[model samples]
Target: MGKLQLVNIEKSYKTGNSSIKVLKGISLEFRESEFVSILGPSGSGKTTLLNIIGGLDQYDAGDLVINNLSTKHFKDRDWDAYRNRSIGFVFQNYNLISHQSVLQNVEIAMTLSGVSNSERKARAKEALADVGLSDHIHKKPNQLSGGQMQRVAIARALVNNPDIILADEPTGALDSKTSTQVMNILREIAKKRLVIMVTHNEEIANEYSSRIIRFLDGEIQSDSDPIEKKDSASINQPRTTKKRDKTSMSLFTALSLSFKNLLTKKGRTILTSFAGSIGIIGVALVLALSSGLSNQLDVMQSDTLANFPIMIDTNEQFVDFSELGPPGSEKSNSKYEEFPEDTTIYAYDYSESFIMHKNVFTDDFLSYVENIENELPEEVNNISFTRGVGVNLLAEGTDGVVKFETMSQNSMMGGFSGPSMGFSHWYEMPKDHQFILELYDLIGENSRLPEAENEIAIVVDEYNRLSTLFLEKLALTEEEYDVTDFVGKTMLKLLPNDVYYTEAENGLFTPANP
Candidate 1:
């Protein structure tokens, strides 16, 4: 017997400063297998009483006993267990998830009870078949008629095989014919379980229910004689069904159910997901753009730096060298008249000055550098030196001639600039002179540095600039001759010092061509 007892049940709500009493001292008892109808007008505490009995809401100052088990010490978890294992709910509005199939709706009770996936699906299909929805098991709620959706709800309520079925207006949304069909299902279910329903229609109540209960103004106006109260005293326990459970709420199960529910409400779920992801999507796009731009800037910087040679200094007072780039970046040379090479004198007189030379760049210095290079963790293939000399270039034609000079300095500006002396020399071309150019940006096409005798690979920057200078010497604009691709087309030859420089009457140096 699905026996239930309530003693002195009290419930109230507070709005503003007033205490609104809903169920004032509601006392009632019920026995098993009775089709009971609760009749009441609006706000007569019928639904509230039903909810309290169903454990959906709590009643203050009440002793509710289910199958002789007092709920006085029952916690929320106990109530939840009662709802899952004992009571089944059927509402007037069906409350079927629109996207879920009839079978899935029935499976919800089992899912919440932590039934195994395979087992729940099988049981869900069985419950639907019992409600004559076996053919529509795969249909969504929206695909069904009002009667069919209500049938699915009934199937769901019965899927757990609960002891007490609390239905509120189960036939309220159906037509007269459909209402009669629903009442038949309820009567059939009441044969084994206790069916307590709330309804306003007196004809349905008087005709279908075995017991009638009337409530008015938060008080029980009438409670009909129990269908068989004497037979219920022997029912000391609720009915039992196999496979029903009081399962604990598992995190994995909760997430799975939540996700399924989300899928049922596709539009709202998609809208909420999109809204939440807006900031994340924006951040990801920003990071992508920033990374791409950073990569491009690194490529540009690498191209600019690759054209120049790497210089290492052993001078103790220096911190860094060549901080500025090529083109107009010449070393500052305003302080000293004499060069460092001239400061070291040898074998001149018997009275010689003692010199304590620190670690400096020398011929034997490279041997020590080689030793250090050998000790490096990475492989070292070759180490060679390319001398940088101070030199100038001349372009001559019928219009006249122009000289492009390279600055050679005497002092280093805290090692922050390249040697003032350029790599080119005015030395005479005796038999053959080979010059190699480091063109960092031209690595993909005709990219070999000059290694053979008399071979030259001129860098594009110097090549284009020299071509522009030759145009200027001819008194012409650069637009007349495109210097964009001037890599392999250029040729060069070395010059002699005496032919390029001459002494003037003022004891100063001058270009020999002028």
Candidate 2:
């Protein structure tokens, strides 16, 4: 039986608003041992038919049978496997990757087949040697002549030992001398496998092909030899074939190709990277400046509220919701009108009396406040001047790094300007107070207060015990180690929040440069 058969294949393409039929009820057969040449004028669908047979295009109607198995139900991966395992193609333009060596170009087919590295190289070398280009294996495509490049393409097609070689005008770009060499190679390849060539050169096709088929207007015009049609029952019966592995190119191979391509166009790659970096840096700087300004504004607001007794909320109003009627009922000075039965209002028509005005404290307004502060009466106590600066405490632990921060002093102003410090577990000790003397007497110790920026004191309860949950969070459980040993041994890294967090593209903060 022939290796491939097409049964009344039909294909069409939609161009804008009209459909053009490319193939019209075409039927043909291909054997494993014949060299067939298809000849046709341009736009006659010869190349389209070849592409369909090669699994590069799909036929809209009718079945393509490969080894008596219908290919009508093949999925994308199945087609990929079929092409990788059974088909090889040589085009008129060679289609060789310009940056890759001749051997690398040949090895690409087997790369997708999941072949071993040593065997892939050996096969590639053998294929190149067969094409009499062993000495030029390391050369790039651009370095070779047109004929040499075409031979390299043939080597690439044969590297995987595909069952069929599809040549589309293999000698279209070559002189007569070079064309003869390529045809001779194809003739040799046809001895053991099916070789189908599409060409317009009548003399070359007649000389090289064992059978010639002419195509005109999407139909077969003449055939030197044609297979007789078998009964539908006999033709439709599918013979069991060995299950094949899915064809896949490895991620490493893909990245290697990309890297090589990048290396080939060094100037363009460098220019692209430089341009992208400039844009990225510009965006990063703008975001960083915006974030810094926002944080500074929060600090200014906190300072303002701390130093002054009055707080002004711009673009906000405090409303009393207690005066409103039940949820979804409109607020009214009079009793609500009775509605029809089974009707309950789900929305409210309400108007607010409070007017919105910008309460922003501009520099001019702050200067006026300063002038008032200077002329204040002696009865008023001195206003406290304070600045809110955040610090992040980091410690290395058995699990990972641990960070802690005290409750922000700005939290007293309101939740508005409050930064996310740690939970409210930290307290500031009052300096030179009578309570400190009493606490020393109760604890039976006279420890000095922290005097350095990096120094801190951990306080325990009257029972000289610490919270177990807090200890676990810091990975400093008593069962794991002597708590006393950690008193002086443990070290913490203190960084300003500005130094710790960097604004990212998504409007959140990530670790600086990380």
Candidate 3:
């Protein structure tokens, strides 16, 4: 009997209105101490099959037997036990905890398996030494290079001394040099322990595995075995390539190797790891603050706005004012001033405002705002602006200049009389009877109206061009003539003869007398 067996497996999932089947009836057998590789293209369900075999997930219908134990009927507790004792897993992402030291990350599996502290430490140290990460015991995940981090993950997987190691794209993220190193270590381990890896790279898989299985569309297409099984009498005899009698280092030996490695570059490793630890500390603080604030807001909002249902209310809304604050307070006010007026700033409001806009805002927009709100200033309130072609302006002077443009036939016919205009207009228009056409150039060639204000703000063709002329018939500098400040404060006043007035709040009369 093989060490692992999958018999008549089938898997399917419900898509919108129909069921999509991935794996058909598939059967396979893998012997102990075998180095096997499952090779396939993307979306071939290689990861899914590996996960099922590793006890990370359940198959819809299958008989999965590992080391003579049937896993198809295993309960949650049984699966956990099986995973701890029977299988080890290595992932492409190197999912090592950044907060934990390299040694600590490796010891996690043994700890979960309830191994003694001394034994776990010794095993983890040994595993690291085997993977050439003995010198990185105290370093966090980010402190090491990508190759070293993956090595740490490998050590973690091996620390528990499981019967089988299941690797999903083990060297997918590593370059050739590092990948070779990793593959060699895995090959060495497979001499005594079974190593089954999922890979897209055929060369690496062929170089390391004695047996290769090709998968397509979630089914095993081909199985090629290099070593043939011996007769019953020779089964008990160890093969030449197999190294069963070779003993792995004990915990003490491993720990000694780890310490010796560390001693070689003590200062350099400590300093680099310390710098990495600082980054981890910063990230931890940020995450903790964000999570804590989010929880507090949730609680406060829940308590205050229980009746409101969707909206929240709070007493104080924090604002970042560094952008608008005095220069000296830039650093101090930066946190508050990060809030943009155009963006909706939401807080834990215990009022009706939350409930009111719940349906008004798009689902995507609300989700985006909710994700960053706790990390950003809370002073932002919902505010929106509507732009129109003409707004009522109260000019200061009695003879204020009134400048207006007639709606084109397209605009009038389409009823685009509101803020949202739909028609287009061209430059170089004929001079009217009453108004003199002073400036009539496009911001750029083929300009759109909404973006026209920003793109066509200045005349690029003419250097030292007169942007505006005063009633005093005096030439003014561009800075003196620029009316951007006036535009924000002023309103538009309609008058006869297609004219309008630019009335400022301070009662200043600037004519758009084009």
Best-matching candidate per TM-score: 2
**For every candidate, C-alpha RMSD to the true structure in Å:** 15.7, 20.7, 27.5
Please provide, for model 1 over 77-127, each residue's C-alpha lDDT reduced to its tens digit, 9 standing for 90 to 100: 677788998999999999987767788788878766777888888999888
Task: Kindly give the number of clashing pairs for every candidate.
Answer: 2, 0, 16
lDDT of the candidates, in the order given: 0.70, 0.76, 0.64
The residue pairs that clash in candidate 1, if any, are: 389-422, 389-423
TM-score of 3: 0.45
Which of candidates 2 and 3 is the stronger one according to TM-score? 2
1-514 in candidate 2: lDDT tens per residue?
7877888999899999999998999988888778999999998899999999899999999888887878877888889999998899999999998888999899987988988778989999999999999999999999998899999999989988888899999999999999999999999999999999999999999999999999988998999988766633466666545466898777887897789889989999999999999999999999999999997976565446543545443446544343543487655433545564766765554446234345566789767755554587432222322234445767666678766545344323222211223354344543333324433333324444566656656655544566665565567666544345545554777777688899988999876431
lDDT of 3: 0.64
Model 3 Cα shift for residue 283 (angstroms)? 31
Alpha-carbon shift of residue 231 in model 3 (angstroms): 8.2
lDDT of 3 at 36: 96
Clashing pairs in 2: none
The alpha-carbon deviation from the true structure for residue 292 of candidate 2, after best TM-score superposition, in angstroms, is 3.7
Off by over 4 Å in 1: 226-246, 249-274, 281-514
